[model samples]
Target: MQPDWALLLLVANVSTLTVCMVLKLPQIITVIAAKNARGLSVRSLLLELTGFLVFLTYQTYYEYPLITYLEYPVLIVQDAILLMCVLFYNGNIGTALPYTVLFILCWRLITIHRLIIDLAMNLSTFISALSKFAQLQSLWKTCDSGQVSALTWGFAIYTICARIFTTLMTTQDTAVLFRYAVIGVLNTWVFATIIYYRKAGKRKD
Candidate 1:
């Protein structure tokens, strides 16, 4: 018999969380060792942070598991530390335009929607899945390009498995199809970019 879908999703989320946590260690190391954010993209990290916050708001307004709120923040903390190490290399953090604007807009626009805020808790699952997808894509791109070092692809692969599992777990409702599309595009872009870099022999700074 097939396992229960909800159970599968829980298992997948837990497993992905584990892998994400483990993969995160090396990012810390890279920051400390290199003391520069050479290979990392500030825009990507900023986008991820904003995405998670939006999801977190949705979860809280709807009253979903508090844990979902924690996940993205945890990832953000790691990225912030990593950003600190690499900040000087990028010159002013202000140079990251994508990160700045989206992060702010997502928060402001969503917060203003009383309906969205009130219904936030119900959207927790989608938010969690979306944030996870974004972060995983960012990390995979970083690892594939040698920006984050290769000691952690195992973790990344595990995270991808988690995303695949999450996609399976979520119901295929109309609005969600768009969200899934976003995830799919991100996955494709990250993988294709990696392939492009490898073929072109563009060494990561």
Candidate 2:
């Protein structure tokens, strides 16, 4: 790749990922302003946080490029705030504070063997994908798509797809490729669910 073209690709990738991260802002705003988390899944948020944490650990251990892993901490913090909102809205602050402490403690205690960390990173990604399913199930049962920001999911799909493409161009690392593919599929499903439920609700009106 030419230097200019490579820089363009780098810029495009980072810009798209930034948009994905920014998309969460609306959700955070909605949750706070509405003071309700009707359709949001705390489990899903926590699972996402765990996945990011593990990925962060993996990247730091392996000394990956900053661009590749820079967003993990941002995402972890965003999810943590969202989790706090979920807890507060549900009147579970006592539980939330202790859980936060425990999370920090557990993160500190984890031993960082390369093989173990790699396995855990993959496992956490799988668990995050499952968590998306659980979140979709919640939306289905409630028929409430309000808690999920379609914009966020849409940008997520874009980000994951872009990452997959970038990975293919840069390195054919099967693990990275598979992880993003799974996440992309999951995000697409969630976005579809949001549209389906939104249309269903409107038709009922």
Candidate 3:
């Protein structure tokens, strides 16, 4: 049977936005329940937040359609909350103030120079990848999922796939498409690692 491409694209786009609304909730809940940020990487969360802000700024600067980048604000807010949870659990909550100031400065500076936005857009993917790798390293070193929710990473992979589909159908910007592609792979890797370690823990009990 031939696929209904239009319906599929619509579904993908809508699902991507909807899923992103709650993408980080699982991790937040996990950290709270575990009462610690073990196996969660502060570096990963910081990089992820930076990448989100940069990408959001780029799309906004270019005046992209609201639906196209609507989910970013939600994701950014959720990530900031999660980062605070990580810091709070690690007894470094005071440091969040400095990071907040830094984010504000970067947000403004990226807009002052047009060339800066373009540079940020290009570097966004690399920064995001490093975030995922940072998480993976944390998991590998500890051999525990701990406060890193597999559910969150799994949802992230699903959303990335949906975004990839919609990006292909519409804008087809190579940079945006490539960003989703790389992050999708890394999300899957992180999800798989979390699951593997969870199962390993279960086996030991």
Which candidate comes out best when scored by lDDT?
Answer: 3
What tens-digit string does per-residue lDDT give for candidate 1 at 72-184? 56665665556555565567756556555756776777788778654543364455445445545555655545454444434554565566546445532333344445555
lDDT values, one for every candidate: 0.56, 0.79, 0.91
Which structure among the candidates has the greatest TM-score? Answer: 3
lDDT of 2 by residue, 113-166 (tens): 666877887787797798798888889889879767888788788878777777
Off by over 4 Å in 1: 1-7, 66-70, 93-109, 115-164, 167-177, 195-205
Model 2 is weakest, by summed lDDT over 10 consecutive residues, at 106-115
lDDT of each residue in 66-167, candidate 3, tens digit only: 777889999999999999999999999999999999999999999988898989988999999999999999999999887778889989999888888777
Choose 1 or 2, whichever is better by TM-score: 2
Q: In model 3, state the lDDT of residue 121.
A: 87
lDDT of prediction 1 = 0.56
Given candidate 3, what's the lDDT at residue 129?
Answer: 96
Order by TM-score, highest first: 3, 2, 1
| Cα lDDT for residue 159, candidate 3 | 88
